[model samples]
Target: MEYTYYPGCSLEASSRGYDESVRFVFNALGQKLIELEDWNCCGATSYMSTKETISLVISARNLALAEKYGRDIVAPCSACYTILYKTNHILKNNPIMKAKVNQALKKDNLEYNLSLNVRHPLEVLVNDFGIEKIVSKALIRLDGVKMAQYYGCQIVRPDRGLDDKENPQMMDSLFEALGAENIYFPMKVRCCGGMLMTTYPDVALKLNKEILECAYGNGAELIVTTCPLCHVNLEAYQDKINKKFKKDFHIPILFFTQVLGLALGGTPKELGLNRNLIPFQLKKTALEATK
Candidate 1:
């Protein structure tokens, strides 16, 4: 029914499209997403690698706020979700890390409590909204559209206690609920080279483009993913990938929430479908297909 959302840095800027779309989609579905008041960054995966405690503290601050709001935090970005959930797990299970993180978090007048749970929108949709409820209002069936549902790295790796770490079918039921044809791809949990996107643009570009090629070659007309970072690395790098590869494979990659919003009869604008810079010039056939 209701949940607080934490949109990481990418959603506010580079992933505004995702931000707007998730808002509209969930709203249309009678799901109320109240964002945490004055919520800060999740510190992302980078912070975790640089300094585990600092990253934990930052993520804990956000998670702590969700606790204050008395609602679980639903994060759309996979990276954001992972960091928040991981930190929450640590705070709940590891007393030493918990105390340290709470002390660091107090600098911002906050503390992490197991009282609040960190969830991805995909998880909330199924667990909270229920599969039958989501299917009840599907106006567009994605059965005709062949696409690869990529979870990238964050959603599955380290398991995070959400679903099977290596073999994840978290978003499958959602896609099926909307009548989308999801191709079982081995690379679903594979990395989009997103970690390298910032440090090594060229490498990131190549790897992301390769994911595109592999999916398309396997009869995929589009690729659906969750993480904003993954979306930026894959969707934003289209031109460079095209130029480097010297190929015209322009498969439109879309956010998982955007696709869910689309199938639920939400308008393209509401779903932020037009927010993509890659220019999806197709209409009527509903080729765009999931998070």
Candidate 2:
């Protein structure tokens, strides 16, 4: 299967690991990702609060570009997925907004017919590709590895119908099918305070602390997430969270694609696992045993 890929801003820099792992995983699965050409930022959550129409126009440009491909647009970042999906929804429902957005696009010889479907890779992988098919392609099994499936807030929110809004099982089912154990985690859908990590470090630290505390309490060896922002908040803020809370939190936060790539015979370096702050490596013995 081939789809138009949108890397957004985060995946290009702060979340390069996700971009790399996502491309690697899809390629390994015999799928193709044709990156949307000349794509611009999706004007993430913050931009909408500043200016609604401008933000919609900024995001709609990418949709107009992707429409030419006549394929579903796959966005790996949760924020990008939500923004693009929301843009498509708004334009389709509100004719006035759609006219304004299309008029703006016309300046660049572009137009949006609302002929594209914005999708998250998680849904495309689990729903479209099928867990059994992915399991069949596994080169290594997770076996007894325990992990917490963290979906953050945006992906399932705004009722996208991808999975259960409250408790998503896509990640759980995929990991379980790969032989990994999904620990019971209640904070799976909790907010990670997002940009608050920059605007209000104290608040973000507390929110992250709660998430880490829940995963740790549930005996999760690692936390697997689909959102890059959540990964940053959880993994990058460990030290701050530990110092402020007087706790020693050292749990490894990994992108779901990184783990999935490992099962698909990808090395740690290939999957960008080495880039993680809290490094994670599967036991060689276990890998050899699986082979």
lDDT of each: 0.79, 0.93
Instruction: Write down the TM-score of every candidate.
Output: 0.91, 0.98
Model 1, 106-206: lDDT tens digits are 88787766888778888788777887887887766666667788888877777667777777776877786566677767778878887797798888887
Across residues 71-99, which tens digit of lDDT does each residue of candidate 2 receive? 99999999999999999999999999999
Task: Spell out the clash pairs found in candidate 1.
Answer: 256-290, 256-291
Clashing pairs in 2: none
lDDT: worst 10-residue window of model 1: 282-291
Instruction: Report how far residue 267 has shifted in candidate 2, in Å.
Output: 0.6
RMSD of each: 3.0, 0.9
Q: Give me candidate 2's TM-score against the actual structure.
A: 0.98
Point out where model 2 deviates above 4 Å: none
